[model samples]
Target: MSRWSGMPRTTRWVVRVIRPFLQVFTRRDWSGADRLPTGGYVLAPNHLSHLDPFLISHFMVDHGIAPRFLAKDTLMTLPVGGRLLRGTEQIPVYRNTEGAAESLQAAVRAVEAGQVVTIYPEGTLTRDPDAWPMSGRTGAVRVALATGRPLVPMAQWGAQEILWPYSRRLRLLPRKTVRIRIGDPVDLSDLEGRPLTEDLLHEATDRLMDTLTTMLAEVRGELPTRPRLDVRTLEPPRTTYKRLEP
Candidate 1:
C-alpha cells in the first residue's frame, strides 16, 4: 500500500479554516478539477504571485487531495512556518545547497506513494516581462522520471491581480477570479526510459514548459509575442538554485 494515500488532514483543516478568509480576498473560477487524479501526479503550474501557493493549495484541499509542496530550505527553517510545513509533511528543496538532491528524492517518493507534489517550475515568479512561463528547470521532470508519475500541467490567472509578486501592493477589492485549469498529462513517453543525460533532460524540460505556456496562452487568450525569459541569464545572485539536475 502507498504510504501517501488519502488526503492530508492538515491540508483539509488549513483550507477549511482559510477558505472563508480566502473568499474575502479573491473569487475563484476553477475548472478541470475533475482532471485531478486522486494522487501520484506532478502538479505543474505557472508562477505569477506568492498567492499561487494558497490558491493552489485551496484548490487541492477543496478537491480532496492533500496539497503538498517542495518548499525552500529557508522556509523550512522559520519558527512557525517551518513547524506548519513539517506538520503538513511538505518537502524542502535545500536551494543552492547539496541537500537539494534529498528534496528531489523525497518528491519521487511522495508521487510513488500517491501524494500530490505541487511544483512551480518557473522556480520563482515569472521574470518574464509578459509573465509567460519562463524556461522551466528539470527538477519536476526528474521527479516524474524517477517515480514514473504523470506531470500534470496547469495554468492560473488572477492571483497576480490580487497581489503581484515582489510588490507590496494589495488590490483585494472587487473579488478577482483566480482562474485555474488543469490540463492533460504531458507526453514524455519518448524520453522516459533513455539515459537521463543533461541534453535529454533539457529537452524534456522544454516540452514540459511548452505545454504549460500553451495552457497559459489559452487562459489569457493571447500568446506571448516574445520568447520566454531565462532566469539563468539574469544577475548571478538571482540565478541561485533552479532545477535539480541529473
Candidate 2:
C-alpha cells in the first residue's frame, strides 16, 4: 500500500467528503496508476481549470495517494477554507514575492519527508487556445532535483468542459468524463547531482513538459500543435501550425 494513504485524520475526512461530490458530476477514466511510487515524489499536472485540483485529488485518493497540493497563498488565507487547507497540510505559494522561494523550499521538504507534493508546472491555467500545456516553471523540477525523488507527470482532460478556464459558469447537465493518465517518471538522471543552473532547469523542465504533452495527446486521441506558448514571454499562439504525432 502507498504510505500516503495513511494520511492525517483531517485530510482523510476531507477526501471522504469530496469524493462523492466529484463522482456525482464526473466519470473517471484514469490509467497508468501502477506507475505511482509508494514513497515521496513530485506530481506535475497540466492546469486546465480551477477545478483541476479537486479532480486530481479525487483520482489520487482513490488510488491510495494523498495529494499535498501547492496552492495559492490567498486560498490559505480564507476564513473557513483556509483552516481546512492548513489542517490538511497543503503548501501555500506566495507568487512573485520574496516569500516565493519559501514555497519551493517547502515543496522540497514535503518530498524529502515521504509525501506526495503536487506542483502544477505551468503555475497557472494554460493560456493556449486549445488548452495544450505551455512552457512550465522550474518549481516542480527543483523539488524533484533537490530531493532526488521521482517527478511524475499526470495529464488530465475534460475538467474544462465542466468549468471553463477563468470562468465561473459550470456545465453540469450532462456529466463530463475526466480522463487522467499517469506517465512514466521523467528521467533526470543526467541532470541529477549537477548544480541547478538556468540552462539545466530549462532542459529538465522541457523534458517533463514534453512528456506531459505527449501523454495528454494519448488521452485525447489527437495531436498537439507547436510552438508551445511561453507564458512567461506572453507569446501568442500561432495562427497556423501542423500537429505533432503523439
Q: List residue ranges in candidate 1 displaced over 4 A.
A: 1-9, 236-246
After TM-score superposition, the amount by which residue 232's alpha carbon in candidate 2 deviates from its true location, in angstroms, is 0.6
**For every candidate structure, what is the RMSD over all alpha carbons to the true structure, in angstroms?**
5.3, 4.7
CA shift of 3, model 2, Å: 9.0
Candidate 1 at 206: error in angstroms?
0.7
RMSD of 2: 4.7
* lDDT (tens digit, per residue) of candidate 2 on 78-116: 999999899889999999899999998999888988989
Highest TM-score scorer: 2
In order of listing, the candidates' clash counts read 0, 0
Of candidate 1, the 10-residue stretch with the lowest lDDT total is: 237-246
Per-residue lDDT of model 1, residues 1-246, tens digit only = 332246466655666688888878778888998777665989998898778888888787677677788899899889988888887889999877899889889998889988889887778787665667888888888888887788888899888787765555677888888899998888889888888898988888899899888888888999899878886675532432223111
Q: In model 1, how large is the Cα lDDT of residue 161?
A: 80
